[model samples]
Target: MAPPSVLISGAGPTGLILALVLLQNGVSVRIIEKELKHRIGSRGSGVQPRTLELYNILGILPDIQKEGAPIATMAKYNPGEIEPSPSPKLPSGSSPPQTYRTYPNGLSISQERHEEILRDQLQKLSCSVELGSELRSFEQFSDHVVAKIVKTNADGKQVEESTNFHWLVGVDGARSIVHKQLGLSFLGETQEEHIALGDIAVEGVDPRFWHMWHVPPKLLVLRSSSSTSKVFMFAYTGRPEHLAENPPTREEFIEEFYDVTGRRDITFGPATWMSNWRPNLRMVDTMRSGRVFIAGGSPFMSPSRPSLNTHVPDATHCHSPTGGQGLNSSVQDAANLGGKLALVHKGLAPVALLDTYSEERIRVIAHMLKVTTELYHKMFSGAGPADPSAWKRGSDLNMLGVNYCGSLIVFEDAAGAGVSSDAYSRAAGSTVQAAYCAPDASGLVRAGSADAPTTLFAVFHVSMHTMLLFGGDAGAHAPVATVLGRFPEAAVRTVLVIPQGQTAADDGALFSAVLEDQAGHAYAGYGLTAGELAVVVVRPNGVVGAVVSNARGIERYFQKVLV
Candidate 1:
């Protein structure tokens, strides 16, 4: 077969997710990791609600839900207190059922398990991560990238190989070779404080709430990772000079825990993984250099520097892990780029479409850095642990409100002109708007069938744009159909959403599917009323790209996105 179109360096969640999305779109991909084996530990364990929605479209939500646990509530203990004191509930904790959202709460699955699920999905597509294979260097041409890769053989001998691909993406963590070789500037501040994190076995702690104890200038948190096993994720901030070990010894961790909580009964076990995390508040000025790109592990921005372009990494952009946005933001970066890259590689969209990746992500990442940094300050602001506001996670962190409102590619008709462009300002409310995460609605029954009721989410495909024509007159369908016919059938899927008890004259042959909004959820989720006619285009990444009133609107929207 011909060479894969994309070469992805680093098989972490970002690379794996990008590879999966590209493969699903029929774009060939090769993913490599410098590590000989998969990394373990519950790093970035919080999978926010927005990420869960994306996972649903990727067809892995079931596995994630099955393997992951809900975000636990905090059980705060004051100094010398054994029993927990009432603590402020995190925004990620349990909540009332949401009418517009399918997955309303954050999940607690370790990064290792998250990657396992993604790798399994990719394996089903006949692709696998090449472990011990590292992207040593790469040179980008106008149309292709030549990369030198070093692979460690079974006997541990290293072999060098040179290959070419249409594009190269660096998801290789903070120290991204791609970002460096591309000459991108990662500008940010390195915080003075340090945090120690580890996954260790602990006995006598309840495996329910996230246990925490505050001893002024120092705080210790032990969050349960398993109900049956004794493993818990431990995080320590403000380590004293005497106990300042890089990877704290088991005895040191135990001593700190005992000193903070005064729990002499609690015993400690061996630690599986440990790290001394120093916050680096940085981001890249650019995210792309011709055919080469980067995502995840680094923080990135659009071009402001002359030398280069930029991920969720220290390479492109990196910040404190306060709101669990690093991994999820990295995944979002991949999701936003994968579809556009696939379309461009397949010659279905203009190469300029790829530029929007950096444009769209830079804003979101900037706001994310601000929010997470604020949370970091609040957590360590000399405020006692009992200060509920210190631990409070707002709904904005859920990322559902994250939007590409002012994106050059997204189009909002006059009907949606009232929708806010400021995602950060209106993040807490549920308002459907253009260039935002596509909301899910259940209780849709396919036309002319008695099959089990489905959902707007159930019909969304990762490989194509889903054009939902909401409550349009019969004549309106033909013009939209004609416009959509200009695009590849595989690239766009058309669905007709009608009000409950409405019957169409045809079997929806002009559309790929006809969904009867049995419970009015389809209209409600899209902020439309029954009998209202509008066209909503959900992009391959599950973002609402356009909210228009007619076929001309659909045409205008795609013109901005496709070739």
Candidate 2:
């Protein structure tokens, strides 16, 4: 049978990731962007730890590390002050035990650079974004979606194209044409306050820190990615009517900057990008309609960064970038949806699996809107964190705690059915639940091969479920393997996690791969004793699908999707 095809709107990080992941799973994908060229800005700069884990699976961690930097200290300045208040340090402790947390901190990189990396990864799969191509409209039939696209030529001519796709995903930003066409209501309110925002070259200011000037009813901020660049992102809040009545000019912006900073030493350079924005909190009640779906900021798109004063003036801002959850949430939305779609396309799972994408993601987005919007209110209410005390970025902001415990696809064996959803009660640093990111345990080596050491993360694949059998002794792995042997090897892979002294040779042909946990970290991380017999089923999206004590449990878990 011909592979199922998917059409994705928007070439931002969310769309790019969805396309790449689908392609990796042998699904055909065509992605388009409305922009004439790639966008430029440092809008969503925070890459949370959960997102970093996803990047690792995509094999783009090296690129992310090269281009991204950690969040710098925030330097607070009161209006008319020369010397800035002492910057506060980020809350620090060693990462939650190495077994549970691999990337404990978030990284900061401009949205433009982040998209460039995603595009590069997508290109490796022999696909590229179609620039100047817009999804004008699409009709969803019971079996397929017919989409009409408009493209602009270099000669300033327009061409129309139409295609049929088994699935259509809208990762387009706020005010998404796809969402509007699908009749999804973006339910939320728009704040009255507006913010003036721009990226510009500046003189005589250090870029090593994020600078903020606090004034009543207005907050000014200047930040740069690195010290070597003269370009900094500048923003200050105001009333919506004020900007409409007296549209800002270059001179006016410079005057406002001086007035807010109270420093004559700093000079403004040419503006690279500038706009005024009003924040809006909005979301769709449902993310999918038949074969047409919306995701990220709204359903799976990055929250309207432009509307929140990131890129464009007239846009939707369902979420503020205060906690840096905007981009991270968007990436996760794509990741979650992509995993389900890949399985359905490959025929390993029924189409019903796709329904869980909205079920799981809507909850996450709801929680995110609450946290980020609260931060926005705090900042605008003059009750935000002050100097000598930074906005404490806690574990919640890192996104490690995001889980889908209530997801329809997730199941728990009888023994694990009562494992509370609290992180404290679960294994160290984890919430004992099915729909959480599986912890990574290091000091793992293949049995008897003596190859380079590996970690649990090294074994994760984005396209299939991983079944780990706790083979405490030489004879405990066979039954687990027998149950896994029933499934297609490509859809469900079986691995035996054995103690250091165990060998694959002991298991004969029942188990093909044996992972030796040298320091017993894998056992401890999974909350197992030295000789406990258990099996863990990790879903394609990195959620722990089930933890069971025997073959019956494994059969029950696979029955959910694999017939």
Candidate 3:
């Protein structure tokens, strides 16, 4: 039998990034897009820090950075020295101090340029893109999906083609054909909400202009990616009544632009792109069912930015022109989904691990929608005192801020109980801290303590009959993989072995290089090192349950936590 194959629809950054991630796991992928050619939509101009990290992983940032222009680190108005707000939300009375992180690895590249890079990467993979192809519909079964695709002809005629897929993902946009066919609920408002969009070119200038707004309705932005520069303008008016019957035209757009900006200096250059869109945000109630999954705007959603008044995930996967977060968020989504699928592909992790994708995304996007929607209402619509105060409560983009505070989320026995990272201004040692730790190097962050330099990798619960290896070497730092893999099923299993100087690949006998003889220590079989790589298993409440090699002994440790 052949290995599982997947059909990914849509070549937007989100779908493209997702395809790259899944392919890393040796899954068969075929990306089908309706466009026979590459087109850069003006949406999703900002790539967030997390998304940049993803590009770094793909080994394509140097190329992206080379092809794209650099973005200013600050949100500044032209001819004005930009002062940072405490955050999107600040204290009511006084101005909070201005601060910026430069996102360490964040960037602002045009949506088109980002897509170009992704397309290049996709070409390198075994799976190639199918242009002029549209997903007419699909049928899901226990093992695979049978999809009907439409092939457009030179005469604009459509012909139907049939194909089978082991798994399918709908990374298609909001008007997803797959979304409609799946009967998945895209619960949210759907109406033409606002009218105002444009692409402009500016000359003879300084480099760093992230975005700018005059006051009230006049919002303009300068963003770049892949050798292209774009400027957009927006207005706070009801959807064009005519759009309901027909698409908005350039003549109509000219009027809306003039009315909102109160100026005619802005004229459409070559009109690279244009759109009349509503600010409605919708998401699928579920991301997956059987062998199918949904991504991008089709499955996950958040409130769209209307003028600089909303929170959106950074621009890795998708970015809207509003807060410039659409692309960043989309890219991050791709990166995150990429990491999870990558690990799953390696078989180093379980299939159940894929379940976390929807769980984490729902929380992140929902909070973004709630907070950003409120920001729009306050900044554009009048801000009631209560609204501003409530919104102020959550302004920082802490990695730990978006928690899996939902139901399907269950603690991994190692998760500490109820320890909110926000409560402490200081760590257990009383030092100010920042950042959370995530399991595995995929960069799919999880809520961890203020622990510094936390070990970042996966811990496998292997069967007692298994032989373990770490970093391809045993006895190296953190050389042992599972100190507990060999323990009786009920006992705490902790494997922390780092070869003092040996690797499994280099040695004929892998276990001897850094195998733990912890049967004598307090941790008994707990994996540890006085000043070396270690793996220690603890109870969900943060009590030490097992370690590699401790002095006290392992028997009492299990007695304390296990029964």
Candidate 4:
């Protein structure tokens, strides 16, 4: 009956997902949006594999897979050329089937539909976005935030209300009030190029391929929309002054489309949404200012203690829409902060855990900006679409390689062999390292039941940390049980994993569940040999919290994370 502890500004994917995570963890949340109605557009449509894994953890992967389509092959048309050349197969679009991954392909779904799915999930959780309600301003106190909210009434009048919450998060886009009020330095450069983007129906283009054209100093792309037939997401890059002076009208977009592509056969329809975007590559020096945080297109916030307040803002960082990392990164920002916020709110973890959100995200965001900026330059460098390097996307863009290695909170008792120094490069050789994205291993059958095989991802929960004991026998149970007894049973789920050819241990009384690695996929995925004793703690957010050798290491790792 009491008011929600968290106030989230901007009901976009970031805020909605953050609220979902908090609510799932039994943390109350109030989410608000400045927009009177949900916007319509196919913006930021690329859903990377890493994001799909996160969606799986949130119990929305089924919906996403149902509603989304695979990334379309690009059909490139050079200047004065009518016949299109298809882009070479690239690893960025999808990964081949592997035992260590579930969702290997990148998905293409409209941002509108993505947010709609997230909103639906929030509704099921007994929460809804307060539309037309804006966070006008907020003053952060030591323990709470006093926010001034402006609501637009049906009569077109604005009413102001003052409320207090334990935490405030801004998911409001680049011009976030939370970021402005917090006075964080948005350090980066604005590129000279400008782009016009919109969603429009087209009559003549093939729906199977993403059409692109390159004329010197001008580039245009029309990607098939996944959710709507005959509708395409349009993007045109041109001179800054030209795009700025000319608004994205239907007629103007149509004319530009023909002029750039040299295709008069395509008939353009009314645009559903349009925007003139400039590449503003910027990020906050710090994601938190006392009780305020920014995220989404910007920064975010969190509380340090039960008595303290926190703020998270949307638009903490904004970059070029090159690698499709905008929406994906923003959602990740929420995922990272949500678990910490929930723990802090419940008095289960110290407020210091909240600091790890900024620490982990800032490093990733900085690298992300650099990668996207490079990709942007490659796309518009006046090289024809035939330049393989310009169009070829590496596996890094999938975001499965993103990790929080070297984070203060993550503990690795021994160095992982063959781990890459550049943690953001690729997911292939980094599974055993702490702070990496947790790997998925199939062919895991429940103890004493091999009728239906399962996966490690299938048993992972959203609100609990999973401790995987690899190759543990009956003798190992006593020490593991003693260490687990020190923590709240509900907060951690212990699972004993038996390798192939080994007998299952009677650990039902000690562990929450037991899994048999029927095909050695579990051991292989974790970089362990058969019968090797190991402890791997997977955080609720699907990150490897620790890679330890014994029960003592497990205690040492959790001591830094939990209260």
Candidate 5:
């Protein structure tokens, strides 16, 4: 059989991440963008905690932190009132710490800069996106997909080409040609909520706060955005009866701004970009069709017998930018699908392994869509609570709780029973469940006489499955060593986490790495007993695939994933 190759449509962050991860794992990929040039402006500008963790694994968190800022505090105002309303006091109380996370809060960075980082990462891997190249159509066979493509040259000439690939992925926006070609229905309603939004150079506006006014006829907002000079993003949501069909011109925007804020003291400069946004609430039933699959905004869904087809996962999107999760969710979708595809390409797992991508992500997206939709209604519906406390950030938006608890590939031994996903929190430190991302914990590795401290986050392997053997005594370590030897070297890895005061050495032949639990964080974080031996199998995507007590359990878990 020919080696697996992939063709991805769209050069947005989703496609770039999917391509980058696939290429890093030695898979061949060709990515195409229909746009003539790179996109500009802050479209989906919020990066969630879960996405930050994914960025850490991809080795791009440093760059993202350098280029982004924290969420801006929203300052409220009323029409004809020059002074701002008092900042709503948040409920005074203490809650459980969010321990399952490293990057706790969401980051605010424009979508354009996010894509630049992804493209740069892809370039470092010796892969680049082909601009002005579009997927016109495709036909999928039992084994491969033939795609018809059109490319625009430097001279503005267009050429057509046809190519075949082992799989096809569509990350194109909502109006996806691939989805249309597959004849999938985008079954949902588009709301009447319309807003005029734009990026504008401005003066006399504080960058630290997101300014807003709940006027009679409309709600107006202004927040800082990264630009050549000081620029702000403005959104004007007028009454449904008064919204214009076309985007407002600069002159009209200035007049509306003055009327709403009653602040001629603030000056509005030229608009950098502007658009009319209509809140769309729709999605396809599934996210795959034959050998061609779609993710992000493509509304193509998988058939009932999805195990027989090649796979890529999906992420949901909404028209309203209530919470900045659109791009973050899409990147996560790519992360999950890319991890599975990498294993399949390496021949360590069968193609059936790809089926879980759709199964797991569909559940996540379904939950997310429901949550975001509820928030949208709560905010826009005239009946929404006026208290700022009512709109406070919650655990749902953080995305740290997303998991594949019921996925086919994840197996938990009897010891793991009752340790459900809800019990697996960084704050709880009582249980860590299978099918969720492994929690990071602190430990120490013996170096000569001195012990060096480290963390579970640092030891996670981005491209290989990490097998953490707790209670790393001689008896615990022996079974893991034998199991590691049985699997392909590139397929699995072993990290022996020993108890306190135990001297451990890196025997390159046996353990990939050895660490002593000098701090007991690993023991507590993973909810393991110092007296009992346990093994945790974490997938390339950082999700715990299984938790078992013996070597027999380890072998059984691998049987489900490996061919």
Candidate 6:
């Protein structure tokens, strides 16, 4: 069967990332964006390391980090003084988020800068984002998926069209037209209180300083991640009822923003982006209603920073300026999804595996909501935090390196054995990725020969199966190879060799090819054990049938494959 060709909506970081990963894995994808134009205003100024790693996989993070300001150069505030919080760093061998450190400490590029990085990555994959197209409706059939699209002309006339695809991912965002068209319910809160947003350049402050005023009634958080002059500020008020018009005005913004900071000298002008963003705590009960999934800030919610219960660790309540977690969460979501899709394509995972995409994500997003919500209330709620000081610490640097505690797509490792984990397996668990693995000239280069077992255990895969021979002494198994070669019909090909102790120049050479190896015995199941160490892989469906190290004979093994 042919793999599904995916149609993705939205060109934000998440959508662009999904497109890049799918293309890399031999999957086809098309992206559609509703925006007819691009934004100059920056939003969501923080990016985290995990997100950067995902970009690394996509091959775009390095340039981005260089192009953007260093996290250490970005300002960090907690209390009396302001300083730069170092980039996010991660401690190895841990699952906690606290172990992770912000790279460049924490950056302050608006959403636009982040998107530029994503767009460039997409281009590297030979793909582009189609603009001014909206996914109005989509329907799923047993074998295919289709969507209704509305496109606007040069003169701004709207025209409707339909697109066909093998699958449709609605990264169309929270207010996704696709979500509504699919009759999927997006369940969450429209913030009960008040939140304000202002996008303007303010005077009377150094470009390098991240200012946080511990004011009562409202919190003033200002930081510049892009140009030094472009300062971002926010105000949270319980009395939003006393505020102005449907669409806000610059006059009103200057009044409210400056009043919160109590600085008449500081003036804001040339509003690039100005809108009231309410604090919403929400999530769709299901991210997939048929073939569409909801992502980004739309369906789910975000609370202002420096508040109570915010995923962020400090008490500043994330009110002023948050530079880390939100962007990190979205990038993480895309990485997890891509890996799962690869398993599905291989038919190595259970069908039910698909649903958990939403199940697990909800767990993470739920945490973000709680953390941000609490942080928002605490910082801006007036009665919440007594002081809005900025603080930076030598972080615990816990990397939120995600692991599949219960993922269904786990595969057997190199030894073709049930290698256990948690140190109790006595054998190392299979590595998550290996083929791309290149040998390192590290101190542990195994030069001494270890005995490799002749036969590996296997139950005939009704379809296909994998097997591995832990590297053992090649010289010890000549008789075995001879016995196996006795059956030329079983194209028993040896793929990779895992060496144990210090062995010869290790390049995964097979027994037949290497001179020191016992050529004849690979057939007899008389191979050696490498001081009891490394393992080698055997291709599935070998010509030879049952070659067991413990007891099976060469003749018997041949009979099984023929039968």
For 156-203, candidate 5 gives per-residue lDDT tens digits of 899998988988998885456787788766656677666777678789
| Error at 323, model 2, angstroms | 0.6
List candidate 5 segments past 4 Å from native. Answer: 1-4, 80-83, 88-100, 226-229, 239-242, 297-319, 415-429, 446-453, 505-509
Better of 4 and 5 by lDDT: 4
User: lDDT for model 6, on a 0 to 1 scale?
Assistant: 0.47
**Cα-lDDT of candidate 3:** 0.45
Worst 10 residues of 3 by lDDT: 430-439
lDDT of 2: 0.73
Clashes of 2: 9
| lDDT (tens digit, per residue) of candidate 4 on 293-335 | 8777631111111110112223778776777888899889999
Residue 2 Cα positional deviation in candidate 4, in Å, after optimal superposition: 1.3
| Model 4 CA deviation exceeding 4 Å by range | 79-82, 86-99, 239-244, 298-314, 382-386, 416-421, 427-431
Lowest lDDT sum, 10 consecutive residues, model 1, at: 302-311
Residues 1-563 of candidate 3 have per-residue lDDT tens digits of: 65337788878777887787666545667888876676544455555444543455455667766665444432433323344333232211211112111123334565666778788887888666778899988888866689889988667888898888777777775456666766677555543445344344434223354343334333333443323453432232444455423234556656654564444544554444444444555555767666677776421133342222221221112212333344545555555455545444444445565676676565566555554455545544443222334334332332222233321322222234323433211112211111111111221111221223221222222111111222222344222333333344422333333333322244333232233222212111122233443334432111122322322233333332222
Computed on alpha carbons, the lDDT of every model, listed in order, comes to: 0.79, 0.73, 0.45, 0.78, 0.71, 0.47
lDDT of 5 at 196: 74
TM-score (all chains, Cα) for each model: 0.93, 0.91, 0.64, 0.92, 0.89, 0.65
lDDT of 1 by residue, 1-563 (tens): 67898999988788999999999899899999887777777667888888899988888889999888878788888876778887777675333233388777888887777889899999999999998898988888887899999999778999999999999999885466786687787776777766777788888878867888878888898877744457888889878886553556667778777777778888887787666666778877777778988887432221121110011124456877777888888889999999899888888889999899999888888888888888877887857465677777777788877888778888878654525546554323344556777889989998879989998877887788999888777787778888988988878899989888887666378888888988888787666765557888999988889888888999999998777
Q: Top lDDT: which candidate number?
A: 1
Candidate 2 lDDT score at position 119: 91
1-563 per-residue lDDT for model 6 (tens digits) = 44237888877767777777667656677888877764444556666544544454455657777666644232333333334234222212222221112232444466777778778777877788888888887788865777788987668999997767767777655556666666665554555544555556777666654555544545555656465545554444432465622324667667765555556767675666555555555555565555555554431233243221121111101122332455556665665565445445444544455675676566555555555555555555545444332222222211122232222222223254332222111122222212111111111112234444332222211122223344444553444545444533223333223333333343434333332223322212223244432222221211111324421333343332222
- The per-prediction CA RMSD against the true structure, in angstroms, equals 4.6, 3.4, 10.1, 5.5, 5.8, 11.1
Measured by TM-score, how close is model 2 to the native structure? 0.91
State, as a TM-score between 0 and 1, how close model 4 is to the true structure: 0.92
lDDT for position 44 in model 5: 69
Q: Rank the candidates by TM-score, best first.
A: 1, 4, 2, 5, 6, 3
